[model samples]
Target: MQGSLSEDRRAQGEASAGLIRGELEKVREEGGSGAYGVFGEQRIAAALKRLGCGKEHGVYIGNGFYSVHTGVVCVSGYVTKDELTSEVHGAYAEPQPGTGPCVENRGGH
Candidate 1:
């Protein structure tokens, strides 16, 4: 077993961010639709649900995933997926537009 999981809210957000980053990275490397495809709320939502974060975070997937429980955002940023590198960063409390340069409002309730 992996010792113990972090109960820290920030750490949990990072975990979710990491998953998204990984996906963006793959698409970036492949040089495909990741710029837009990764932004799809449905896909990201499914992935988040599989990660079992929804319950603990009071999560609902729309753009990325935000914590209704803590009022903390777990995912944010955009994916360039072009010749440029994709961007992924920490969550912001004030809801952001998922369609633009942000990721659940992103999925916020």
Candidate 2:
């Protein structure tokens, strides 16, 4: 189960990268300031929702970096037990979604 979950996180994170890149590029094209939250939270949420991972997930984007947090979460600002952050280019995941008190480490903006 853990293996599968990790694989899923990796795959999902990689897959979402392209979408995020496109959105960021669009912002740049539109003359938007190169700043965090430029893409807005609603847009990010909508984009991630398409991935179909319905446990706990979110996205954080800033400057030229982006991170996607999925699995091992129960909702925004919360995490499950056995919380382990498997990071890949700012992205993170876990073997399986736990039920702990792992607050989101959304990084400094």
Q: Please give the CA lDDT of all the candidate structures.
A: 0.43, 0.38
Name the 10 consecutive residues with the lowest summed lDDT in model 1: 81-90
Best by TM-score: 1
lDDT tens digits, residue span 1-109, model 2: 1222366555665555545445434444544332342444444444445655322454443323334554432222211121212233322233212422223344454
TM-score of each: 0.38, 0.36
lDDT of 1 at 99: 28
On the 0 to 100 scale, the lDDT of residue 103 in model 2 is 31
Root mean square deviation (Cα) for candidate 2:
10.5
List where candidate 2 sits over 4 angstroms from the true fold: 1-9, 34-56, 61-65, 72-109
lDDT of 1 by residue, 1-109 (tens): 0112245756765655676566545544654344344444445444446555454554434433333232343354444433323222333445345322233343536
**How much is the lDDT of residue 25 in candidate 2?**
48
CA displacement after TM-score superposition, residue 78 of candidate 2 (Å): 23
